[model samples]
Target: MREQQENAAVLRVRGLNVDYQTKKGAAKALKDIDFAIHAGERVGLVGESGCGKSTLLKTIMGVLPKNGDVTSGRIELDGVNLLEVDDETRRKARWAEVAMITQSALNALNPVRRVGDQIIEAVRAHRPIDKQEANALVHRLFEMVGVAPERARDYPHQFSGGMRQRAVIAMALALSPKMIVADEPTTALDVIVQDQIFARLRELQAENQFALILVTHDLALVAENCQRVMVMYAGTLVESGPTEEVIAAPKHPYTIGLINAVSVLGSDKQPISIPGSPPDLMEKIDGCRFAQRCPLATSICKDQMPEAVVIASPGGERMVRCHHWQQAEDFALRASNPDVWQSVSAV
Candidate 1:
């Protein structure tokens, strides 16, 4: 059963292009994004801020803002294209098939309602269950997430930050969805709380075997929690592979910068920052979006976009979107030197 679950894909995204209409023009939030997450797998999506991590999650959840549009894409969940589904069908699927745990727990919960009642409402929305059944389910979920079942009636404000996040996790798991999208679920908490929350989440994931998509800027968190990692930049997927391989030896310049920027404990090495900011999405971009900040970029990189290349790896297939990926080993050595990144000037 575990092997079969690993072979089945829970979510598959193909040729996804999302744009947000602005006064200036349409800002490309996601460009030709494609990936898949298998059942019982955990994949981490890491990138700098404004790299369309949230945009991609929102698109998957069918909660994009009014101005944001998926111009082209097929979001296949369990062999069904969610884009073609009606609003009612999608709404029914949101928490039942695929649920999202947002970054802010306070905003996700209703301020006026009791926490248990909110979770009860979520459970009853999709399943035909009476109040007693829903209440029982909520209590079980709360216990699963390490929150006391008796305190389910507390308001959101009554729970501490970590507890609120735990409640959100319980709500997400209330319907026993096949997939869970957690967008920096513990970003606001301190180290100790963060560790405790992740420990509980790992335990629950082990018991339930739901596919998890964790979105965060912290590579260390991804390294510890995820089996695979996808690196995004300027609304594009730059690199993806097994977590250990990708972190130990990155292929894309942006990914290398991200890995190098993480501060290591007890290490004398200073974190190297990427020199320039991301390109403006509103402006028309030619060639590679990262060319201006990439030290290894050449004339071709400045004139044309690089296609995604697949490389065989011991753990799994690795994908990189860089024209100079063939020379990544040499580049990786130079990238460790701060001078290489600092020499590049933003155009």
Candidate 2:
């Protein structure tokens, strides 16, 4: 039996379909995506570039570009439908209810303004508080994120890369938001700094009891920081479940391929790359998007899309979008053989 949590979900996304209008008709960026994040729950979204991971985050935050539209979906926060709300209401809810830490601290911060003022501005935008109160809050936030409270007056250029990122995180936490979406929060930083940033994030999440949706290309990072994992491919979610179970025994071919591709320390087995490039979103695919690359794919897989199959596990319920998920044990064994993945293109 699947374990059901008693706590209500903090964020719920159902049947989300996002499209972008292009010169060649419309491109589907997200298709029927659904998930939920409960209070203090950490979920990771992992995929290659152009897999719609970032687009999904932007859509959830209501910051999609002009060309992008949520053709169908429901985004709810604490039972409030965000997409159904008025513009003013959604605008007001942006920082106070849901905030994001973008990929780059250099680009996200304003060059001219002091970091302190920017954070204070964010706090005052939602809260009816004076500069002094906001400033005090900013100091507390800085302390929370491990940045020196005295350095709040410094400009963005004055802080190191990691410290700058902490400042951005401080801004996101100003309103005590129930959920935070971090897109590659530790990108471009050194490995040591990356560990530090995630440590701080884990500490903050524990202290505040806020939900988190972390988007990144690093499967190792997802395994380390998130309790749940969702794997995306060509704008579709292929596998989702508890992090430990999914990482240890992947059901989908794509998920297995991803695990095989990761370089394990001191392991004798060499990393094997998944064959073939991701499908083109502009083209209409009638079958499984990964059919061309999957070693276990058959004629049926090439002719039809697979629906998600739910499997109950001790950790939680596992979801795999592959027709052959029932033979996952066999697939896992075959996927371990580097020879099975030794396509000429992979070399």
Candidate 3:
């Protein structure tokens, strides 16, 4: 049965679970995750480290490590099951139908090759274009990414950090993909450069009308750039909704913790760190994955898994996985007080 909506989405992931083999046994990296993005939509995936954000991206890209396996569920691209397709079809789909902009531009690019050559090769790999045509396209791409067209001949080391990232963006755009999954594309860059890179990405995304999935740890960044946001914890999606609604009134305790963890610039209030570490994935979780760290956790939360319920709001409908989401607004209001989290230990 198709779990996707009747209208369909550009990309849909349903009941997806991933595991990685360890010495003891297999560790669950991702739990029954479900989400969909429509054409030209912008969505953000935000979580602390080791919350399966990268695992989800790698699974969708079909680049999971050798030890990792997709245990169950389906990943659909425009209604086609990506997980069920043959290797040949998957190979052709990558970088052509959907593309990725990696986290670190420095490591993603080859130090020895000329940036232009890399871009030209990427274009040729997907399409049978002559060298002259490829070169012209490379020049145009360089221009589009804020790099001087003539400087395409230079090696990656010669370009500044921001310029290198821009070049990577150009390479991702070369195939004119329908969707782009950017995994922390602004990491390691200065504040100014991060702003510039995202600005360019937003402009290009608007111009081309491609769906975008941005994975990051920055809640503020998501609030500013993404139309919708999904929050993950201990390999499970705790909450997701329209950006404004989620940021303003988070329903899940974990979601509320994440919002309170960041403070506005120049604000008198200090950022409140969420206490306790994430649960170990290799071990079995008896109940709610977040019960150990959540301030509002109750006996039921420690004994049974919570189901995701859709709640209606003035803005739109949102999903939250919690037993006590009805008290979310009250808890969210209390979460701002540092004393509320004093009992929990910080990492």
RMSD of each: 1.9, 2.3, 2.5
C-alpha local distance difference test of each model: 0.91, 0.88, 0.88
Q: Which candidate leads the pack in lDDT?
A: 1
By lDDT, rank the candidates, best first: 1, 3, 2
- Candidate 2 Cα deviation (angstroms), residue 207: 1.1
lDDT of 3 by residue, 1-347 (tens): 13433354889899999999999999999998988887788899999999999999999999999999999999999889999999989987899988988889988799999999998888777779998898889988987888899999999999999999999999999999889999999987998989988988899989998899999999888987999899999889989989999988889999888888887898887788887789889988867898888878888988888988988767556889999999999988888887787665321
Error of 2 at 222 (Å): 1.1
Candidate 1, residue 280: lDDT: 94
The lDDT, on a scale of 0 to 1, for candidate 2 is: 0.88
Q: What tens digits encode model 1's per-residue C-alpha lDDT throughout 178-216?
A: 999999999999989998998888888899999999999
Estimated TM-score per prediction?
0.97, 0.95, 0.95
Backbone clash count, each prediction separately = 0, 0, 0
The best candidate by TM-score is: 1
